[model samples]
Target: MSEASSSLAYRLRSLRRLETFACLAAVIVLLLLPFVLPDFYVYFAALVLVTGLFATSLNLVLGYGGMYQFHHAVFYGAGAYAFALMLTKAHAPLWLACLCAPLVSAVLGFLIGAICVRLSKLYFGMLQLSLGSLVWAIVYRWYSFTGGDNGINEIPLPNAISSTTGAYYLTAVVVVVCLFLMYRIVNSPFGKIFQAIRDNPQRSEAIGVNIRLHQLKGEVIAAFFAGIAGVLYVVVEGTVVPDMLFWTVSLEVMVMCLLGGWYTFLGPLLGAAVIVGLRTFTGAYTEHWSLILGIILMALILWLPEGVLGLIVKPANSKMELSAETGRK
Candidate 1:
């Protein structure tokens, strides 16, 4: 192999090592944080995890699949409503509620994806947005089933666990598992095809790939994960409301994906943490937290267009090396 190829391989190996160490260190720190931090902080961390998962799920489509889906909140809200209704109305177990949340969201995704897969780019996104808004309106106006504007309150925690600490641990475990699964999916052949579809659906289709089928699969996967996040969110908040299903929430998830650098696997997670951290810290001192967040987001967009992970994982400077090696040969 050429010197440039060798150097690139070496750099990739080093990056993989660094990532492994970072993951290990993060796990260690998270495990110890609950012991030293206050209960409120633990709860805050749980919220971050839940929100991060939700954002990352959206990234699965927006980042990898190159589909700007504006209806992600529909699945998230559906999961939240499913969990609440199951727990309160059906008196279901927490585990069962969690399982059903993603299933319902997957069903919704399948139906939506089936219809939207035929369209490309903006049209698909607009259609999903319209469908999502329709669902949100139904939930908001259906007073008999959804509890309407007041929402469903006093949602009981899982009977198997009583303490907030237990709840935090449960959420942390679930979030970690979900993230790991996402990581695997993104690194798999299926994920590669999704990226291919994102980069050029027409070219991929020309190469005998079933573009619509692949995109639909990705949509369903993303929705399933978002559903899981929704369940965790309601569990953490101990309540469910129509606002959680709004268009703004979908925008927020998209913002997190963009802020984190859509190309990087861990970008959405870091972005979510940053957003949640900023909100928690700023909200404590100022009522104008929204203004502050807007300014920060603007700065990030202008200065760090690639997101935080992009800053860390610099593109390999191999072009020059390749030219040098070719000259030597």
Candidate 2:
């Protein structure tokens, strides 16, 4: 390789190492935050972590897999409902409930992904949306089981982590672990294949790749994470409701991903922080919190189309075009 290319490669490797260290340092700082911050802030931070996890799962499909599954809330809500039912109806322990919740959502994801994999991109998204709506409708109508619009209340937290501050620390640990797992997955060979499929499914298939299987695998993995986020949400909020399964919930996850800059691993976490911070601050001052949020989202979409992180990274100049032209000459 040329000296310039070698230097560029070295710089990229150095940057990746720096990023990994920075992420670890950030997680350590966050774990220590509960000691200094107020109770409310700790709770807020926990909520942000949960929201970030949910958005990151969405990114697994939309960002990496290039499949827009609009019904991601199905898995999230399914997880929450699973936890609630297990705890309330079956009288299961907190650990067991949490474990079973993600398993249930993973199964649901596998089933949905299996069926949806046969359809084209747009149709698959639409079908997922329809299925999500169906789940929401059932949750809403079934008052006897789900408590209808009122939601299930007083969900127990893990015994070892009883206080909100303790819960915040626990959640931070989980979020860090999840983010690390996601980072590993994205840097793995499987991730390369997923990105290849995203760039050109036909080309990947021609190369002997099973596009459907890869897509389905990605979807199931995404759902598993989303399910874990849902369990965390129930723990933090101490409730689970039908509205958690609604289309709006799914849209919020998408918005978080877009706002964070879908291309970067940390983008969803930053996006979730922004959203949660805005909501908490804005809702305190005015009754029109939704209007303010809508305006903010519109401004971000219009002005920062690539999201906040994209603005920081900046686009690389296209030397490939010049190289191709020179070769032709």
Candidate 3:
């Protein structure tokens, strides 16, 4: 190999070592968090994990696939509602409810993606927002079914996972598995095509790749994981509200992505923690927490364009690295 290639390889290896160490440390800390912290903070950490997963799922399409998923949180809401309804209305078993919930989100994703992939850029995003708004409206008004604006509360959770610690552990496991799978997908050959299409759709098409099919696949995968996060939300919060599907929720997730670093694989996760932390801690002090959040986001956009994590882990500029680096891969 050339000297430059050798240097790059060495840098990658060192980065991988650092990432592995950090991950191990993080896992250890999370595992012990419940025992050390109060119940409320434990629940809060669980929220961070699920929210991080949601944002990461969005990053798969928005950051890597270069798709505009303006109303992505609809899939999240869909998953929550599906899980809740299955358990409450259908009287389904826990396993069945969990299994079917993400599928519902996936199907919704496929349907919306089928149409949205036909367009690009702002039009695609707007169409998704419109469709999402329609779903939100339905859920918001369906008092008989979805409990309308009041939402479905008193959700029955299994005894094993009903407690804060148990729920936190469950959320931790699910989130970790999902993150691993997503990380694998992002590094796979399929993810390479996603980046190629993102960086240059015309050239990718000219190279005999089916662009629309791949984009649709990306949508379904992202939605499926977002759905998983939603299920976790129901577990953590025990309520399925219309706000879950609202456009503003989607925007909040997008902000998490930008704040964490869309160009890095784990950036959204970090962003989610920061956002959730700010909301939980700052909101406790004053009602004007949004002003602080807005200022932080503005600062991130102007100064830390690559995101907070981006400072430590520089984004892979090459399309071959899937347009983003996990710093682990």
lDDT of each: 0.86, 0.86, 0.93
What's the lDDT for residue 182 in model 1? 95
lDDT score of model 2? 0.86
The digit string of per-residue lDDT tens for model 2 on 1-329 reads 36556666676689789987987899779978988989999999999999999999889989889998898988998998999889998999777998999999999999899989998689999998887788789889999998999889877666556578877877788888898898889879999999999999999999999999999999999999999999888877788888888998788878888898987777888898998898888888898977887887899888987888866764442354444344455
The count of residue-pair clashes in candidate 2 stands at: 0
- The residue pairs in collision within model 2 are none
Pairs of residues clashing in candidate 3: none
Q: Give lDDT tens digits, candidate 3, residues 1-329.
A: 36555666787789889988997898899899998999999999999999999999999999999999999999999999999999999999999999999999999999999989999999999999999999999999999999999999988898778789989999999998999899999999999999999999999999999999999999999999999999999999889999999999999999999999897899999999999999999887899977898898899888888888777677444532642243324
lDDT of 1 by residue, 164-229 (tens): 677677778888889989999998999998999889888998998998999899999999999999
Query: Candidate 1 regions off by >4 Å?
Result: 2-14, 159-162, 316-329
Order of candidates by lDDT, top first? 3, 1, 2
CA displacement after TM-score superposition, residue 26 of candidate 3 (Å) = 2.1
Q: Give TM per candidate.
A: 0.91, 0.92, 0.93
Clashing pairs in 1: none
